[model samples]
Target chain A: MTERTATIASRVGLHARPAAIFAEAAADLPVEVTIARLGEPAEDALDAASILALMGLGAAQGDVVVLRAEGDGADAALESLVRILETDHDA
Target chain B: MHTYSGVGVTPGRVVGPVRVMPPAIAAPPAGEQREGTTTAEAAAGNLRSAAAVVKEELRGRAAKATGDGKAVLEATALMAADPMLLKSAVKLIDAGASAQRAIWEAGDGVAAMLLDLGGYMAERSHDVLDVRARIVAQLRGVPAPGIPDADAPFILVADDLAPADTATLDPAKVLALVTAGGGPQSHTAIIARNLGLPAVVAAAGVGELADGDEIFVDGGRGVVTTDPGDAEREAASRWAEQVSRLAGFDGVGRLADGHRIPLLANVGGAKDAVAAAAANAEGVGLLRTEFCFLGHDTEPGHDEQVAAYKGVFDAFPGKKVVVRTLDAGADKPLPFLTDATEPNPALGVRGFRTDGTSPGVLARQLAAIADAAGQSRADVWVMAPMIATADEAASFAALCTAAGLQTPGVMVEVPSAALTARHILDHAEFASLGTNDLTQYTMAADRQLGPLAALNDPWQPGVLALVQATVEGSRAQARHTGGPGRAPKPVGVCGESAADPALAVVLAGLGVTTLSMSARAIPAVSAVLRSVTAETAGSLARLAVSAPSAAEARSRVRARLPVLDELGL
Candidate 1:
C-alpha cells in the first residue's frame, strides 16, 4: 500500500465540482483508493471513489487530508490524485 | 365547458393541448416482490439489468445536454452505474429479498446516509433519490418518471415544478403553465413571468386533467375552460392581442392628466439589470445587493464587490439606481457572518442590524459602492434594510456620507419604521417601501407558510394603513421644512405590490412618487397608470384603506377602476 498527504487547493474545498472530478479519477484507477483525515486510522476512512464520502470530509482550502491506495499501480494512482487535490479547479 | 378558477400570477391568454408532468415516485414497498422470488441469482441478475438500463438512458441524455446541464447529467449517470452501489444492492438481494426490493433498500440506505451527513452531502441526496427512481422504474419495466418530450407547444400542468425541472424546460415549447399546487409567489410563478408565459397557480382539479385535452387559459382572469367554444377563444385571442399592443407602448409612465410617476425596474442582479434596461425602465428602483454576499463562505473582497456593483451600475448610466444593503438573517444564514443557530432569523440579527457584529462587511460593501458610483455616471442611491429606529437611520446616513456616497435612504420594511416614518425620514434623504416584508411583519404571518398566504396579502386594510402612514410621514417631514406639500422627498414603492397594475394605481394615489417592479410587469402597470388620473387614484387609495379586509379592499379598488377590467388586468 502507498500513502500520500496533500492540502486541498480548491477555494471551495473538496466539494461541489472538485469533489466530483476527484472521485471520478479515483474510480478510474486500477487500485482501491481510500481517503481520511491526516493521522486518522484507515478503518474510519471512506472509499475515495464515493463522491458523497469525499464531500463529507468538509476539507476546506489549505486543509490537510491523507490518501491511501493498494494493489497494482497504487503508487502511480495516488500521485496523480494528489496532483489533482493540489490544483485549484475553480481557476 | 368545464372550468376551474385559480390565482393568475402572470397575465396573458393562450389555448393549447395539455401536457401533464408525472409526479415524483413514492417509496417502493421494502420487502420481497413475491413468495418464491428469493433466489440470489435472480436478484443479482435483475439488479445488473436495471442499473445498465438506467445508465444507458442517463448517458444518452448526457450526450444531448450541453454546458452545465451536461455535467449534472453525466454525474447522475456515473452515480447510477457505480460499482459500489451495485454491490450494495446485490448484498441485500442475497439476504432473501427480491431484486426490486433489494435495489430499493440499497438506494434508500445511500440516500439516508447522504442526508445524514448534512451540508454539501445532504444536497446530493436528491440526486441519489432521482437515480434510485430511474433504476426502480427500469426494474419494474415502467417508463421513467419526469417531464416528457413535446413535439410542439403545450400547456404544462403539474402538481408543482422543482427549480431543476424548470431550468431544463424549453420555454418555446410551453404555451402556458397551470399547477395544482404552489402559490403566486412560488418559483413556477416567478419563472413563468420572467419567460413571458401565462401561468395560473393553485388551480383545483388540475391534476385530474388528462394529456392532449384542449383547454383555454385566460391568465389575467385566472380562468381555465376545457374544450372552449369558438367565441370564447376569439375573445381571449382579441384580449391577448390588445395587451400585447399595450406592452409595445414603451413610453414614460403617466396618467391622462400627465402626472409623471417614474417607472423603474426592481433588479436582483446584473443580468436582470440588462433586461430592465432593454425594457426601457426609466431607472432601477431596487438593486438588491444580496447576490454579492449570498452563496459565499466568506465575505467577498473589495475588488469582487466592486466588479459586481459596477456591472449593474454601468448598465444604467445617468439612471437612478437604488440599492439595498445586504439583508441576511436566520432565513438565509451565512456561517461566516450570521450566527449558525437562531430561534427566529426574521426577527434576529439581519439586514442593517448585521452591522453590529460584522462591521467590516458593511464598511467594505459601502466602500465598493462608492467606488462603483465614482466610476459610473448612474445616479446611485443607497439604503439600509430593516431599520426600525431614527438613530439607526441616522447612523446609516452618516456611514454612507463617510464613504462619500450621497443620497442615503432607509427601507420601510418594518412596521415600526412605517409608524415613525417622519422621524426616520428626517435623518435619511428618502425612503422606499418594501411591501412584501412590511406585510409579513405587520400581519405576523410568515410569507413562506402557504396556508398563511391570505394574511400576507398587501391589499389588507391594515397593511394599506401602514403604507398610508409612510407616505403621510414623508409629507409631514416635507411640510416641516416649510417646503410645498406636493411631491415630498421621493417616497417610492419597490415591492411586489408595485408589480400589480391595480395596486400600482392605488399606491400612486397614496402619494408614492415612483413605482418599480419586475421589467416584464412594467408594460401592464404602465398601461393601467395611463388611464387613471392622480385624483381618481387618491380616491381609490382612500377606499382601500377604509375597507375591512383584503378581499373587500381589492373589490372596492377594482370597482373604482372599471377600465382595469376592460384591459383584462
Candidate 2:
C-alpha cells in the first residue's frame, strides 16, 4: 500500500472541473485508489475515480486530503495523483 | 374573454395557441417492491441499458453543442454513465426496490449530497436532478422534464423557465412567452428580451391557458387575452409587422436632422454578439465580463479569459466593443473575493471596490483584455463599474493604460459618480450611465424588490437629474481634453432606460452620444430617433427633468411625442 497527502490547489477546491479532472486522472490509473480528508479514518474514504464521491468529499480549496493506492504500480499511481491534486485546475 | 395582467419585460404582440410546459417530475415512492429473482434481473438489465441509451443521447447533443454548452452536455453524459450510481441502483433493486424507483433514489442521493456541499456544488443540483428525471422517465416510459416539442408556433406558457430550458428554446416555434411567475429581473424575462420573443412575465394564472387554446399576448401592455375583437387582432398584427420592420432596419441610428446616435447592444457573453450583429447594432456598448467568472470555483485564468473576450471582439470586426471589468460584489458575492455575509451588501464593497480585497483578479482580467485586444480586429474599450470618485477613475485609467488599453472609462451608476462625472471623465476617457443601478441607488430602492419596482423607475426626475448632470459633465470634460478638432468625450446610456424608445430620445437630448440596450429594442428606438430631431429630444429632456415624479415625467415626455403611442412605445 502507498499513500500520499496533498493540498487541493484548485481555487474552488476539489469540485466542479477540478474534481472532474482529478477523477479522470484517478480512473486512468492501473491501481484502485481511495481518497479521504487527511485526518479522517480510511473507512470514510471514497473511490478516487468516482467524480461524484470525490466531489462529495467536500474538500474545499486549500484542504489537505490523503490518497491511498494498493496494487501493481501503486507507488507511481500515488505520485501521479499527488501531482494532479497539487495543480490548480482553475488556473 | 378573460384577461390577465403582468409586467411586460419584452415588447411586441403575438396571437397563438398556448403550450404550457409540463410540471417537474415527482420522486418515486421509496416503498416500491420488485418481483422475485427473474423479474429483478430483468429490471436490473433494463436499468443498465437505459443508462447507456441516455448517455448516448447526451453524447449526440454534446457533439452538436459549442463552448460551455458542449462541456455541460458532456458532463451530464458522464453523470448518466457513472459506474458508482449503477452499482448503487443494482443493490437497491435487489432489496425490493423497483428499477425505476431504485434509479431515482440513487440519483437523488448523489444530488442531495452535492446540494449539501452548497455554493458551486449546490448549483449542480439542477443538473443532477435533470439527469435523474431523464433516467426515471426512460424507465417509466414517460416524457422527460422540460419544454415539450410542438408541431407549430404557439405561446409558451410556463410557471417559470430554468436557465437551461430557456437556452434550448426555439423562437420560431414559440411565438410568445407568458409565465405565471418570474419578476422583471428573472432569467425568463432576460432570455425573452434577448431572443426578441414577445413575453408577459408574472401574469397570474397564465398556466391555466390550456394547450391549443388560442390566446393573444400584448407584451407592451402586459395583457394576455382570449377571444380578441377584430380591431384588437388587426392592431396586434400591425404592431407585430411594425416591430419586424424596425428589427429589419439595417441603417445606423440617426435623428431627423442626421445627428448620429450609435445604437449598440448590451451583451452578457459572446453568444449574444451574434444576436447583436443580427440586430444591426453599431457595436456592443456593454459586454459584461461576469459570464467568465460565474459558476467557476476560482477565477478563470488569462488564457480562458482571453479566449472568451476574443470571441466577442472577433464577432464585430472594426466595431466598438466596450467591455466592463468583473463587477462582482454584494448581489454577486464571489466566495473567494468577498465576505460570506454582509449587513448591507448593496452599500458594501461591490463592483470596482473588489480591487481592495482581491488585487490580482482585476489585474489579471485587465491583462487578458489587453491580450485579447491585441488579437482581435474589434475596437475594445474597457470600463470599471461603481466608481464614485475621480481618484479611483484616475487610478483605474492609469492601470488600464499601463496594461496597453488606451480607452478606459467608468460606469456612472453611483450617484456620486454621476454628480462628479466632469472630474472623473477628465481622468477616464468616457462615461456610460447604467440607469438601472443609478435609479436604484438614487431612489434607495432595491432593484430586486418587486414591491419597490415602481420606485426603481429610471424616469424618476431625481434619476434624470443625475443623468443630465453626467452628460453635461461629460461634454465639458470632452472639450477640456480635446485641444482642437477632437470629438467630445462620449457619454452613452446602456441600461433598461436605453430600451425605452421615449427615454432613448430623452437620453440623446441630454447630450448622450450613444444608446445601448437589448438588441431587440434597437429597432423601435431607432425608429423613434428618426421621427424626433436632436433639438426636440433636448426639449423633452428638459421637460422630463423638470417634472416632480417619474409618472409625471413619463407622461410629460409622452405628451410631447404623440407618435410614441402609434409605435406602441
Candidate 3:
C-alpha cells in the first residue's frame, strides 16, 4: 500500500465542491483509495472515491487526513490525491 | 372565487396554472419485509437499478445546468450513486427489508452522520435526503418529490422553500411564487425579488391549492384569487404590458411637478457598487462598511480598509456615497468586536456602542474612509448606526471630524433619535432614517421573527408617526440653525421601505429628500414617483400617518394611488 497525508486547504473544508472534485479524481485513478483523519484508526478509513464518504469524514480546512491506495499505480494515485486535498478550491 | 391575502414582496400580476412543490417523502415503515418471495439479492438488485436511474436523471439535468446550479445538481447526482449508501442499503436488504425501506434507512443513517458532523457538513444532509427521495420515487414508479417538472410556466405554491430548493429554481419556468409561510424578509421573498419574479408570502391556506389549479396572483396587492374571472385575466395582461413598457431609470427621480428626489442604491461592497452604477443609480445611499470587518478575527489594517472602501468610492466618482461605519453586533456580530454571549445582542452593545468597548476600531475605520475619500472623487458622507441620544450623535460627529472626514450623520434607528432629531441634528450634519430598524425599535418587534412581520412593517402608523417626527425635528433644527430659508438638512431614507413604490411616494411627501434601495427597485419607484405631484404625495402621506394600523395605512395610501394600478405596481 502507498500512503500519503495532506492538510485540507479549501476555506469551506473538504466538502461541497472540493470534496466532489477530489472524489471524482480518486474514482478516475487506477488504484482503489481510502481516507481517514490523521488520528483516526485505520479501520475507520472510508472509500476516497465516494463523495458521501468524503463529506461524512467532516475534515474541515486545516485538518490533516491520511490517504492510502493499493495497486500497480498506487504511489502516483496517492500523490495526485494529496495534491487535490492541499489545493484551495474556494479560491 | 376563493381569495387569499399575503404580504406582496415584489410587484406584478400573473395568472397561471399552479404547481405545488411535493412535500418531503415519508419514512418507510420499520420492520417491513420483502413480499412475494423476493429474495434479498433481488431486492438489492432492484435498489441498484433504481439508484442508477435516479443518478442518470440528475446527471442529464446537471449537464444542462450552468455555474452554481450545475455544481449543485452534480453533487446531488453523485450522492444518488454513492457507493457508501448502496453498501448500507444492500446490508439492510440482506436483513429482509424491502428495497424502499432499505434505501430509506440507509439514506437516513448517512444523513444522520452528516448532521452529526455539524455546520457546513450538516447542511449536506438535506442533499442526501433529496437524493434518497428521488431513488425511492424511482423504485416506486412515482414522480420525484421536488419542484414539479412542467413544460409551461406555472405558479409555484409551497409551505416554504428550503435554500437549496430555491437556489435551483428556473425563473423561466416559474411565473410566480406563493407560500403559506415565511415573511417579507424570508429567503423565498429575497430570492424572488433577485430573480424579478413576483411573490407573495405568509398567505394562510395557500397550501391547500392543488396542482393544475388556475390562480391569479397580484403580487403588488398580495392577493391570490382562485377561479378568477375575466377581469383578473385582463388585469394580468395589463400588468404584462406595463412591465414591458417600464423603461430603465433615466438617471433622475422627480415628481410630476418636477420636484427632484434623488434616488440611491444601498450597497454592501465594491461588487454591489459596480452593479448599482450599471443600473444607473444616482449614488450610493447606504454603503454598509460591515463587509470589511465581518469575517476577520481582528481589525483589518489601515491600508486594507482603505483599499476596500476605495473600490466602492471609485465606482461613483462625483456621486454621493453615504458610508455607514461598522455596524457590528446583533444579527451581524464580528468575532473580534462583539460579545457573542449577550442576552440580547440587538439591544446590547451594537453599532455605535461598539466604539465604547473597542475605542480605536471606529476611529481607524473613519481614518480609512477619509483616506479612501481623499484618493477618490466620490463625495463620501459618513454615518454611525444605533445612536439614541444627542450626546451619542455629538460624539460620533466629533469622531468623524477628528478623522478629517466632513458631513458626518447619525441614523435615526432608535426611537429616541427620531423623537429628539432636532437635538441630534444639532450635532450632526444630516439624518438617515433606517426604517427597518426604526420600525423594529418602535414596535418592540424583532425584525427577524416571522410572527412580528406585521408589527415590523414600516407602514405601521406608529412608525410613520416617528418618521414624521424625525422630519419635523430636522426641519426645526434647520430653522434654528440657518433660519426658515435653509433646506432641511437632507433627511434621506436608506431602508427596505424606500424600495416600496407607494411607500417611497409617502416618504417623499414626508420630507425625505432621497430614497435608497436595491438597484432593481429603482425603475419601479422612479416610475411611480413621476405619476404623482408633491401635493398629491403630501395628502397620501397624511392619509397613511392618520390611519390606526399598518394594514389600514397601506390600504388607504394604495387606494388613493391610481398610478399603482396603471403601472401594475
Candidate 2 to native Cα RMSD, angstroms: 6.0
Q: Which regions of candidate 3 fall more than 4 Å away from where they truly are?
A: A7-13, A38-40, A52-64, B26-80, B83-146, B162-166, B268-275, B287-314, B323-375, B382-430, B440-456, B473-489, B531-535
The DockQ of predicted model 1 stands at: 0.37
Angstrom error of the Cα, residue B357, model 3: value is 9.3
Writing each residue's lDDT as its tens digit, candidate 3 over B477-502 gives 98998996998887899988898999
Model 3 alpha-carbon miss at residue B395, Å:
7.7
- Rank order (by TM-score, best first): 1, 3, 2
TM-score for every candidate vs. truth? 0.89, 0.77, 0.81
Docking class of 1: acceptable
Better of 2 and 3 by DockQ: 3
lDDT values, one for every candidate: 0.83, 0.84, 0.89
Steric clash pairs (candidate 2): A13-A61
Worst 10 residues of 2 chain B by lDDT: B447-456
Q: Is candidate 2 or candidate 3 better by TM-score?
A: 3
Best by lDDT: 3
Query: Candidate 2, residues B1-569: lDDT per residue as tens digits?
Result: 98999777777777778888877778887688786655778888999888888888777877867777777777777778676777788999888798888988888888888867766776676677788788887887776667777778888998887678765687879988888876565567768877888888777777677878888888876789987778668877798677656656574999999999999999988889987887688999999999999766578889999999999998899999999999887667665676645788888888898898788888889999999999999999999999999999998998898899999999999999999998998898889999878988998987665446467678889999999899878777767777556666889988878988888888999889999999878888888888999899999999999999877888889788877778776
RMSD of each: 3.3, 6.0, 4.7
